[model samples]
Target chain A: MNPAVWLIGAGPGDPELLTMKAVKALGLADVVLVDDLVDPRILDYCPDARIVRVGKRGGCRSTPQDFIQRLMLRYARQGLRVARLKGGDPCIFGRGGEEAQWLSAHGVACEVVNGITAGLAAATAVGIPLTQRGLATGVTLVTAHTQDGGMPDWSALARGGTTLVVYMGVAKLQDMRGQLLAAGMDAATPVAMIENASLPGQRECASTVAAMADDADAFRLRSPAVLVIGQVAACRMYGAPDAPALAETRLRRSA
Target chain B: MNPAVWLIGAGPGDPELLTMKAVKALGLADVVLVDDLVDPRILDYCPDARIVRVGKRGGCRSTPQDFIQRLMLRYARQGLRVARLKGGDPCIFGRGGEEAQWLSAHGVACEVVNGITAGLAAATAVGIPLTQRGLATGVTLVTAHTQDGGMPDWSALARGGTTLVVYMGVAKLQDMRGQLLAAGMDAATPVAMIENASLPGQRECASTVAAMADDADAFRLRSPAVLVIGQVAACRMYGAPDAPALAETRLRRSA
Candidate 1:
């Protein structure tokens, strides 16, 4: 039997970032349960399918986890092709693993289609390589907010020697900056705050880890933004409309 | 003027994993530069365009970076649309940032399109989430080998609360296992070694941080493989043909 449900990552913000595999899944979908963060434009790929908004955005009143799972199960049980669409890669803090396991336990077949994650897209949109050689050995993608309301191990991350990309960090700039400082991260370490990454309305604020909170406040950074922290964060390969202080930062990009 | 050069990611090994943006770029290309690791089937999108093979696989005598850059520059100088396709995200250890910066310095406009990175695809292919809530707060993507011949800070990574995904690690499983063990990572921490991720030939061998090297040896794991190290690495949401030891490991996948 064919897979009844597909958990697809709609990609960051840009609809074009969606994978061809994801588009194929959407085309076959009888109903699509989309997250709030997914661009509405992506739904155009599956215009004939029914669309359901089951947003679970932080600090917002939204659908409960169990209800969403049951809804997908109910739709799949009826032999309908169901698509659970989430922003960014479905498994990256999107509860895709949980949902997939639940469906599989119920004897339903499901497949996950990966997408361009927000952390990676946020850095790339502004010409910052997430793992730029010599500057960073690798990249770490974490979120400032967790389900338990606690924070990630800032001390370990500060010493990890990889570019740190923090999702959902707009509201915790000050707290994050302070924690990183206490963790002994360099005060002059560069940070790039990118909002609405990969979208036409994308905006980037350049600052140092020590000055990030202040710079973000001045730039009026908002939610749905990612913070890139490392030497590579200072690099901008080419000037883009979203970058306001491109001239100053371009000097930092190394070969 | 349109971008003269487009550095596109072909995703893991799946041709369908190519993004719409990458496909659009391919469609507009006058010449296409392909990498060795990239699936040739992706060239279907740019069938009418001139195709140049510029493979740069590790441990192989492949195209030189400088020569590839100059070739792209020469093509772009002629005002041609050049698509440089690499496996996975261009900016992630693909020298995309370096190439883009070089091209931009020479007055050529280049764009880097994000892709579903191989590390993420490998984990998801076997129903494993790189970042499962409670099990892992986040995920770190790093390469086992480095240009400078130095290793990443394993101690800090071991202490960091995230799932670790290591690319180009097939040959160094023994060394990596020792390093992680030396860095205080739990000996029994689950490990999933995935080969040819997201492709039809995908294969998985499940073991632990301590026994990975031995298990991989027994499984005859080859290059183009990725190693997932963490508690979340044990979780397999749904069984697939790639996972030969699914029965034993399924019991360990925590909800």
Candidate 2:
């Protein structure tokens, strides 16, 4: 609250998902630098704070990272409490580490408040237990889009026996599918493409490792969507017609 | 507010870390079934609700999962709002999926409100970004303890080029170290064992994959601790006297 930068995750889309700590930080904020992906409703908590939208959409002409950092620094130097609101958990591909390190080096104190990450929220919204027993031993969250525009180690991921959740992967379905298949991943492994995760407009398209690209094309999957690639994607616990209970699904699969 | 079961995550032992949705659910609860790992302070929000302590710690005399499910069903059947508070996010190794499925199968409506998982919170508490550019492409959250008492696919996890966050791993440090070593993970890969993540008394012991067991022994790492294993674990952005800025660290590593 004392003229420092608070790097807060606004959680995935839904305002209700915001943590009490994040809300408290927003309340103390004198100037807020928020990302485009963050819900504006969350700003209601910081009604008195000066709001600055630092939109940095992937593949879009948006605010540069350096400029955003300088803005936060300027506000902090002016003895104003600055809140940098990001979508999802700030440390999870949100450039929180970079910003925190930069702020520290520039002599601005920074505190990171964790939020519900998009990948986890998207999976749960669709009733996919990422680390369900008998299906996945663990869950791996990776971004397909990188600064170098390269790909993750698909072969190792395919072999990991963990549910793979890919961020910024909707556009690269074909390439990912090809790589996973080539890495000997089962074609029948389930895949779930979730759009606008945790938002009211959230949509899910279920497919398989072999058919996701085509299924996504048919489903009109968009950017900002998350892809859940694993057997658990087929295990829906929510209201889906004919969708077996997770326990039953695991029992059947194991049997 | 409806007469249904709400599986809420208590968010890594911090009461303030609770989501607004989880808080709302707790407010409307007529009965709250709480886990042992959940901090007692969170019950402050549901002071009016009947609190049922269902301790289910591993290797301890605890409540049975079946009995817990039945308790939730009983409360819901009586037209009472039931809140089942689990530590961390319900779906992330907290059995939220299994519980939701059980409630749904019993014709009881259930909802899951996501909370900040312990692994992510633990990483951030120590300024270890789970996924920093050039250091880790993504992160894997896995539990070393399982219902079947079997091990995860360590060889594949070792091959996967993502940071590894292990829950319930304090007890199996040596076994995991051996498997990861056999699987070809670098012995010097940095490891940070975080205890009581996100809490005021949170403690972190930094060591290498080869030396974690000994370090944890020296640090007396306890149960309910999370282990972060990766190159990024060696990278601290806050308060370390010689910790380099994340950008510089990444540049140096890539160079």
Candidate 3:
């Protein structure tokens, strides 16, 4: 039997949102490779499968990309069904294509199952429309991490009439804000940061681009947070100005 | 029974991607107001329900926006369970908020069930990573439509190291290219346009942003096509030539 692999998207940390296809694959897996952002509850669906942790976290020891690929190949060569579980959708920043390409090149069959990305789920969960008529008609999903951990090109991002969503940006919130501001983005442009999105301990804070970094720190946000920056972030309608303002204050103090 | 409306996202034109929750809502809908882009196959899921075609198409005569809202209210007032089915996720340019707000103001309860957006699905189907390490750490979802049927603000969208996905953009492909070029975006930036993504007869063409509009017309693409622009668009190994040649073709043609 040829060893095969299934690449599954866990869907924004919500076990229930896992697609029927993903669930079926998990149940049939002999080995499961999961990322850090995937909810632990999903393991319950594959009680008989062997679980391996191959999650990557910034600024910490991580399983090398090449090593992970090798492990998948090795297991498949042994005729073991391997399931590579990724957070959110496998295609979005999950390096799924690379894995699939490698597997296909080595005569292994691979299938990609889609999942709900965190950016969309976070925007929906908070009642913030990523695109709205007469407000924002487009949205940009980005990350705060660069090779040097610096801000991305702000000159292009400050263009009006588009929403920007940033992933893994909590650590570089202040730098991102500074870049956007330097790029001529409005100081008052609305920004929202969601920590542990779709998880039970989820926390969402709304502020302006000028205040997001400092404010997120005060809220004590951790990694795996998603940042939504644009006019739509202001539409959360929490009914309290103090909530945003206080969160900013807390972030500034913590920083 | 108080009349309530549920707004459901149909997911990227594929009937199977519909969530179990969304399917349940459709099963319970007394009346379903579906958009033009929704696959007819989904209607099979609601054989017992009344299906209404209220979808607005670009360039074609569409039911007035206000009238659509009023129709929802009109149905709900008669104690009918209504499902407003939209192609792609409802909140991403689906005008779901306008409908939700209208319902809430009229004391009608509204529930929203999120669906997968086309951009992510398109990326997955074509093997492009929306966000990838050392390439793009971010992605932007944008539309090609504006209030006056012109291009949206392109200056802000030319930001480097980000992926841009445009929905309903086929008609305005040329305008979008010009605007992005004028806004300092590299002419060689990779772009992929997927027509009828994830469905039967799905067609995808890849070129640089400079060449996209011309080639798209050559392919005779239609509305409901998705445009993904950025470095990530170039990452897919779909047997296309590298970026420089594609950009040169676009430049020579436009010049």
Candidate 4:
């Protein structure tokens, strides 16, 4: 077979969430290029394939995108089946498009296998509905970073009636809170920060947008955390047992 | 095993996109309760299971939510292994919560298996990136339906800078466009609608938010369409040959 590249999404830290297509692609890979956010256990699916870590963590010393693209090109040129494994759905903020473009430009065939995105996984893991009938009608997934590492456009995000899921936003909680509030967002809008979603070590912190900036230290959340803001965040229950309590709390607060 | 109910997302119309956990659940189910949006091909994995069509399509006389909940309860009472299969991720807007709550209250053990949502799959199927370095920092997933089958509040959706994915919104394209424009959304925001995404008979139509309402009629799109609006929608290339042209179109439009 001609050299080819398979861009696969590993889903959000859960190996079982991997699509059959993604798993098959990994099993057939001659070399697997994995990212930092992807669970290491996923490598077990391709026991025979050589694994290489092309770590790309935000705000860390990581492999440059160009270098990673070149590595994929080089490997494919040598008649190797290369798998570029990404966290979450590759097309959703995983930079898979750039990699696919580079591979296609270099005359290498490429196929993209979709995975469950972090926003969806975080919502499920925390029992928060991204959209509900009367509570929230829409969901917005965003990040805190810009090209120059500046804050995102907060004015647009402050719009009410939309659930906002912020990835890599824990550190900027204070700034984000202030910006949203300043842009006419209700100060008491519900906010929940989920740390390490889908993993055993997952932790959740619930608060209001007004309190997030002041109580940011209480969560002790790190990178890879997801921040959900809207009425839906208020509906999150710790487990099946807390469902009623969570709903009642929201009802009381809203009343 | 004790009587139990498993709520599984069947993925967005593609059998291969089902998670391993979902597939396993289907294999073990004694009865499968499915919705209209779920691809019929998924039933192939559960050949021995009794199939129940409890589908609730919009604007159609469908089974009430309470009625559906009662059916799950009845099935579990018979000591059956029931699987409630929904299209896309169950937690997002699938009413999985109500069903799970009903099951728990009735002493039926329930577990949710997440599946790939149409928003993410639609984005990938059409080569659109929900987020990019300088283009979009966020994405929003919403449905077009309200409880009374009217338009959702567009004032909140009109805010700029987030990619918007609308499920089941094709029939209401004209109303959606009017609402967005009235709420001050930019006229040129790119929008792409994919009908039957990830399935054979898939059709994609690209236009602006302002023009989509009128142009969607030209495509004669039907149900199960996923509409994506933002700079990302411009990333889609019908075939691999138009990659550069697509990118150029995005860049030129943004500039």
Candidate 5:
């Protein structure tokens, strides 16, 4: 068997979301290095492979990325079909680029299997069309957390005509509100926060930017939520309008 | 048996890219309304269904979106499991939101199955990461063809730290190049155009903004191509450089 690495995106915890290529890759893997966000039940697809949870949970003692890279190389060198499974699309925010670059640098054959990122999944669950004609022509995907707490240029994103999806942004609503408001984005811009997207118990807190902080708290939205902001976010789902006046309601970010 | 309308994303022309959920939904459908971009071969999954092509191709007599919605309603009202298949993720650009909303307005049960959008598929096909740590903090998905040919605010996008993917952009690149250039983006910013992503005939043309007009003219890249711009566009896929000096070198949009 040709020993190469397969970087697979497990697709936001829904096993059925796995692509045919991902299932095939799992079947071929000799060992799988799974991140924390990956649904544990997904490992059953590769019953024959050894499973290693190399991911560090948020704010916990976690595996260093370099160590994970070294471990992948070690197994690949041993003629093993190594599969590194991340939570969503490997290209989105899971550090897949650095790992892919490392594997390429070492001359290991690699194939990246894309999956539905959490952002899209969250949008579907919340019933917002990410890019709508005449309403929003563009959608931007960014994370609330960045390397070393470096900030993203929120002002640029506040420009009209685009929707924004912020992954892992539950903790930054206050900061984002301040920055975006200062950047002149209307305080009434609709915001939809979807938690546990695609899962059975998923919840959504939809409101305008000015009230999202309080809405999130009142609704108890948690981590891993995908936050959508824009006119499209104000859109009512196909059949019924939930909180039809959400955009007009105002509340401060609850500390 | 439950009669419901399933809106499925057929993904970017690759039969194998269909998600497990999409396949399952296809199998349950009694009728399918397919868009032009979807590969016809994928219909085999639903052997028992009657397939209809309702897509309006560009520059040709096309099916009106309202007519398509009426057709979906007729089928669903008849208690048939109807599938509306569009190429790429339906939510990304396919007017899926409007369809789903229409169905809901009529009180018909509809479920949206997310599929990979063409932009992400193009990125994977081109071997460039859409979002890389530090290099690209965010990624934007937009379409060049908008209703009424109105313009998106190009000045804000010129703010660095984002990678842009423009769908149906071939016709608009020269215009975008001008707007973005005027908006203060670096003329040397990298751009990679991917045509027929995830298909056997897939090809790529990599160059810089300043050279792209000539490069696209020389290469003859056609519609359905995805344009990736920003620092990530300059990224060498996570391996040893395939063409180390691709940006400086000129390549026509290979047919």
Candidate 6:
């Protein structure tokens, strides 16, 4: 028999952001595997379910990926409705892909309920538009969770006029800044770091890439902060469109 | 008095994907400016509110950016609870930033509620993970709407080992394919087109970068289809993480 598993995104620490579908899924789940970042309050949505804390925090004592998959498979075989509740969109950084593939291989049907990604939430909380007219043609969501991988080639990323949202890159602002600057990214490019977005203790700091490390350090920004790099970072600072007031503003971007 | 205005993302095309916050916001709205592509059924969440269709379709008769902003400002100044209901995440490519800034400049308070982006929904619909272990480091959400602007620098976009999700690129696949190839991108890069994603009429097609244009034409994929290009597109064909059974399956990413 196919395993009953649903991978649901918990949506960036905000319980209200949970989709009606995610809430319904949680209500129906017989067993839930919660991520470390997922708020414990979310478990209240699935009160009847047996909850397991699978803290997959980066570089921390966490559950092994293989073992987690095994548990899901075993519970699924027993006819329990297994819900893998992850923080943020399950597909985008949550390792939902691997679990889905494993479930599929074992003939378990998996349904993914998309949720608000942290990058989007972070941008919203800080009033930074990830994409705006005449500036960002797109938004690239990348992570500093490279693990064993080398730093990504930032040259192309720097040139595209797209908003670059670096997740988990708080520890290496200098390296990130150096790569973008070396790739001809303007030193004046505005940068904003939003930490603990949407939470009560959310903090925001803004500066140029050249001085981002200092600003981050000065602001005491920590991990889970989204680093926004692009022209859109200064959208609010610049006045109305066609208004020449912000022309002399130092945050002006040069492509 | 700052009119209560909300920027709500309706999610891809599925009404159920709407977040609880967005639903509540919609119900509280006195006037809602709906985008061209937004499903009409979404308005049921706000049956008492007045709905206005603001067409922002690329390369078509759409609403002017300035006019829309002005209307929003006017209604907001009149103290109407205005809700700008956009199809996907308002901040990502929906021009929500510009509108929000315009409203803020005019002293209108705007609250943004993040929603599920189409690219994530599209990938989920087909069982293709946008980011998975050992293959994709990130996902890039871009668009073919370069109206009045020159085509984006494809060279930089082609370098990163990130999944490229092109929104509204169905009509310009040839031009997009050419740029990626000229930028020295791999010829065999996988591509998947998901049209009408999350709707009953959804259709999916898959091919390689070299043959994507032809495949798109042959498949008759239309506008608004999300085109995914990266190695992970071929992930499902490779089967289990440890199993080598699906190694020989060629480009079976389509649903």
- lDDT string for model 1 (B1-255, tens) is 458999999999788999999999999999999999999789999989999999888778999999999999999989889999999999888889999888888888888888889999988887798788888989999998777997888999999989999999988888888899999998989988888887777878888988888788878889899889999887887755443324333222221
Candidate 1 stretches greater than 4 Å from native? A239-255, B239-255
Put down candidate 4 lDDT per residue, B112-195, tens digits, no spaces: 778988888877776776776667777778888776666666766667577788988887888888888888888898888887
Residue A222, candidate 6: C-alpha displacement in angstroms: 1.5
Residue B153 shift from truth in candidate 1, angstroms: 0.6
Q: Provide the DockQ value for model 6.
A: 0.55
Residue B164, model 4: lDDT of 83
Candidate 5 per-residue lDDT, tens place, A20-89, comes to: 7788899999999999888888898999999989977677799988899899999999989999999889
Best of the candidates, lDDT: 1
Winner by DockQ = 1
Q: How far is candidate 4 from the true structure (C-alpha RMSD, Å)?
A: 4.1
Candidate 2's residue-wise lDDT over B170-254, tens digit each? 8899999999999999888888888888776777778888888888887777888999999999876665354322212211111
Q: What digit string (tens of lDDT, one per residue) describes model 1 on residues A2-42?
A: 58999999999799999999999999999999999999999
**Candidate 4 C-alpha lDDT tens digits along A46-152:** 99999999998877999998999999988988888999999998877788777776677677778778898887787777677677667777777778777677877
TM of chain B, each: 0.93, 0.92, 0.88, 0.89, 0.92, 0.89
Q: Local distance difference test, per candidate?
A: 0.87, 0.86, 0.76, 0.78, 0.82, 0.80
The backbone clash count of each candidate, in order, is: 0, 0, 7, 0, 2, 1
**DockQ of structure 2:** 0.66
Q: Report the lDDT tens digits of candidate 6 across residue range A158-201.
A: 88768999988998898998899999988888887877777766
Report the error of model 2 at residue A172, Å.
0.7
> Candidates 1 and 2: which is better by TM-score?
1
Clashing residue pairs in candidate 1 (N, C-alpha, C atoms within 3 angstroms)? none
TM-score of each: 0.94, 0.94, 0.87, 0.91, 0.93, 0.90
* Pick by DockQ: 2 or 3, better one: 2
Clashing pairs for predicted structure model 3, backbone only: A139-B141, A140-B140, A141-B139, A142-B138, A159-B156, A218-A250, A218-A251
Q: What are the chain A TM-scores of the candidates, in order?
A: 0.92, 0.93, 0.88, 0.90, 0.90, 0.89
Name the lDDT of candidate 1. 0.87
